[model samples]
Target chain A: MSSQDYWKANLKLLSVLLFVWFIISFGFGIIFSEFLDQFSLGGFKLGFWFAQQGSIYGFVILIFVYVIAMHFLEKKIGIKEEENE
Target chain B: MSSQLLTYIFVGLSFATYIAIAIWSRASSTNEFYVAGKGVNPIANGMATAADWMSAASFISMAGLISFLGKDGAVYLMGWTGGYVLLALLLAPYLRKFGQYTVPDFIGTRYYSKTARLVAVLCLIFISFTYVAGQMRGVGIVFSRFLEVEIQVGVIIGMIVVFFYAVLGGMKGITYTQVAQYCVMIFAYLVPAIFISILITGNPIPQLGFGDTLVNSSTYLLDKLDQLSIDLGFSAYTENTKSNIDIFCITAALMFGTAGLPHVIVRFFTVPRVSDARKSAGYALVFIAFLYTTAPAVAAFSRVNFIESIQEKSYLDSPDWFKNWENIGLIAWQDKNDDGLINYSAGKPFEGSRPIFSDEFGSQGQREIKNLPTLDNSNEVYIDRDIMVLANPEIAKLPAWLWL
Candidate 1:
């Protein structure tokens, strides 16, 4: 990939991951929390669960996914750190 | 051993460990002082970063805040942790690639403006000083409660201990000491939670224990909590009390603020590679999630346990824990209508008439009872929410070993 293509791919990846983040934290966790609470998970309402623990778990998973995805992307684009050195 | 003696021994030993680490890891040059010689393992840096990020407020007030806020407390849980996502995705790798010693350094060179650098420095100083003041106050609170000294004396002792290690070892010393602190703080936070979880829900793992059925009851834990809250005239535990707009604003602001915090961002600079910086953020969240997840469990269990143990009891018949907290001015009770019963509820005091409690009267016990709008004049209990977590074990009657 050219340098411009590499940068574009990176930005696209960020946007996708960030979109998931926004939905989990602000969307389900807050705006639709009451609606989600109509369902139950164990003793927790689905919405309440999303707000308290689900969003946090989602964040942790999201970051690691970004890390792994970026590692693969770097190799495919021939922009790995070793190549630069 | 007596609890006070145990406290002295544990606190003294932790202080010694910190000072010893300072001596062993003393920084001889600016590189070591600023960035731990840039040789720290990602895992070790992650633990240190976790320790640095989990400040006094996280340690002392977070669970207490959550316990009172109920479902509304999700703002903090999501806000604080969600910011790490922003940091990892948007800032950490790029800042690591930039390879600067400080945030201002990165901003100055990137923006190409000396004026921008100076402004960044000023903003950094202001934010750091305000944050340090809260941390110092947290130190004093822990000392005064555990060591039995006045808050001022506790603060002085804390300053002296910090000066020895922080001034001597700089970032190098702090990094190692923080790893140790992470162990102690997490242990201190988790042990009681495990014990309480087992006591209330018959499960040792607090996360699962929170959802488990209450001991000796068929009802699930959250169901019991919702009922208890309503019985006490408080909102249901699972109900959302905050407006969607307010919650969104607060959570978003905290997420952005956590990502932008200077101290937290600086932790990325200590790692060896940009890749390691990414992994370090992941590992740090893992460590932080251990406490963040458990804290809600602690809050839920404590709120349920407190109501079961204390509600509807007469002041004269209250437990020793209640009296102990009262001595510290954290719990108060007045008979109001001369009925001698404590009525805890969620509405405005005396229907918003604001009857001054005896403590607020200040040497004149002549406040008119008739002027207060209380139903039967029995609205006289004031309990500071900070006491909720610290007093949890005592209220639950957990073993003394977990008290520390």
Candidate 2:
């Protein structure tokens, strides 16, 4: 893929990941939290769980997911970052 | 050894180690100082980033804040971690490509304006002063609480130690020091959390422990806590008191602030490859999560322990730990009922927020305060939110050296 095309693909991946990030943190964590509190995860109210721990766990997972996706994308584009500077 | 002497010995040893590391890793030149010669390994850099990002506030104060704020504390939790997502996904790669590797450098050159560069420098200085002030306060809290020194002495001592490492060794030295700090921070934060979790819920893992039923009880810990909060006239432990709009705004502000914090942004420059920059953020968050996930459990456990420790107890029967904190002036009891049973409820016991201690002993042998009781509600305890975390080990009666 051309550099511009590669950039576009990267942006697409980022947008998708960030969308999940927002939903998990802002959406479930705050906006729809009261509604979601009707449900329970383990002994925790679902919204409370999200507010406390779920969003943090989600963030770590999303970042790693991006790393893995980018690794595959880089391989596909034959862009081998030099291991040594 | 007394807890006091033990704390001093432990603190002294740790300070020696940090100074030793700082001297050992002193930067040789501008390249070494600016970006650690741009030679840090991704994993090491990540550890450093976690330490740099976590700060003194995260180490000492965050769980305390979370304990009191209840559901509304999500702002700090999500805002901070979310900002990392933004930093890693949105800003890291582009900044890596910027080549200059500093925020001020990026702004100046990007705008092609010396004025912008100067402005960036001014902004950094302002932000840094506030950041350092918070750091010194964290140091002061630890010292005053643990080692029995004045808070001012603690801050002055902290300034000297930080100057030795950060100012002398610069980023290169700071990174190595922070890597060590991250380990110490996570270990110190988690050990008590695990102990408290097991003590309260018969669970070793604090993340799940908070959700587990209280030991030998049918009710869940949260249910019990919610009941305790309501019985005491405090809001339910899981309920939100801050307006949703306020939570949203604060969370966003923290998110943006975390992303834009100069110190954290600068850590991305330490890595060699752009991919390493991304990976480092991931690793940093992973390290950070060890504390973030456990903070709520600590908060819950400490809150439960604190209320159980003090509420509805008489001044004559109050625990030494209670009196110890009260002597420090973080814990104040004004017996409004004249019966002297220490009544702790939602509102302040006196006017103007904090009590003005009169240095005259009350009839109950409590340190007398000049502030008149507001008499709005019968809550006679004035407990600083900071006490929940700082006083946890003492409240929970954990060993002196478990954290040391």
Candidate 3:
């Protein structure tokens, strides 16, 4: 419930979110792309999907998840703006 | 069978969809017009933000730039998208919590000085206009090629279309309409990528095609491209040729600039909660990456296709695609070897001042024309690399539907 605790929780979430970001962009884009490309889904190779569409889709989903996660965190940490009755 | 007709149909469809969305979601109040009543769903906001962020530069220009730059071009890839990290961590949440209608409002309020607000406005106007000029140029090119109209007419049409809804919807109108634009732009971008990837690598995804070995060749596609580039006096395609200092500075500037951009920063303000702003920043990057990641693939595939298939071939022997782009002044060459074939070279700008004529006035003012080098340098004129993306689908002989 303390300010310190709220900061800790948000930082944790951000770190995790950034990890996913790295996996999609750097992992699939440059490093592990060749290995991933050996696999195919639909008409797209895995690496190609990650580069062109998948990473982007993952990014959108992550942000929305962060929003929902923040709501719970806000309630726990006492920063929730009062909803209009 | 009808490439020209298909372009008209697709462009017409996109225009219709955008206008319909604008009319249906027309903003009644300044608040609604600017921020969509501050009630947009986060996912929808993400899509709208993506459209707003991508611009004509991303949709139409980046690939062409990358195709030419080869590995040195990663600055754009890393510079443009990496800024979202700064936005999410440093800027978006605070701006959202403060909650303002415009970026200038935030700077004015946060810094707590009216001078700051005025300065912010001036900076915003300058940056926005610079970017808008690029978009207007892009629209003119797209219109001129696809519709067989003059570039001036195309520019006028684009300005009118953008003005109609931009003025009517304000921010709110722009937001909703942007979501539709995002769909059109992404589809226009990806469909061609998918087809080209298949044609070249037998891989449907472009990102993988970069790493995948060429479809029938023993060499990896990237390796093959690097070889082709070296053969033609270009640095290897995948090698980093830029100074690390230049790369570092450009990357940092692009990251900060992306975060600093007034329009992108404004998108976060529309969200209802501080957390939503952070989330939206992340979402916006994801949406943007769709185009960003695919662009390199488009550039690489098209580059290999052009060099291997079109460049240096005789005028009579060149594919129909080359002749078409050449006529539009988008592609050009000279047989430098005098072998009756195009020999590509980077040409220098001529030393004399040639007058440029403007359509707005028969003789508005005399602006010195800089005759930059063309791709083939046969004529001593330069072809701007931006033309590549616009002309690529045509040059690659992809189906007409892919052009839209």
Relative to the true structure, how large is the alpha-carbon lDDT of every model? Answer: 0.82, 0.85, 0.71
**lDDT by residue for model 3 (B199-286), tens:** 8888897766666776787667876777778776778676556765665577668768987888888887777766667777776777
Better of 1 and 3 by TM-score: 1
User: Which residue runs of candidate 2 sit more than 4 Å off their true CA positions?
Assistant: A83-85
Strongest candidate by TM-score: 2
Q: In candidate 3, residue B15 scores what lDDT? A: 82
State the lDDT at A66 in candidate 1: 90
**What would the DockQ be for model 2?**
0.76
User: Candidate 3: lDDT over CA atoms?
Assistant: 0.71
**Can you tell me which runs of candidate 1 are displaced by over 4 Å?**
A78-85, B348-379
Residue B235, candidate 3: Cα error in Å is 1.0
lDDT of 1 by residue, B145-213 (tens): 776666687778877777778889978889999999999989988999999999998999998898889
Error of 1 at B159 (Å): 3.2
Question: Which candidate wins on lDDT?
Answer: 2
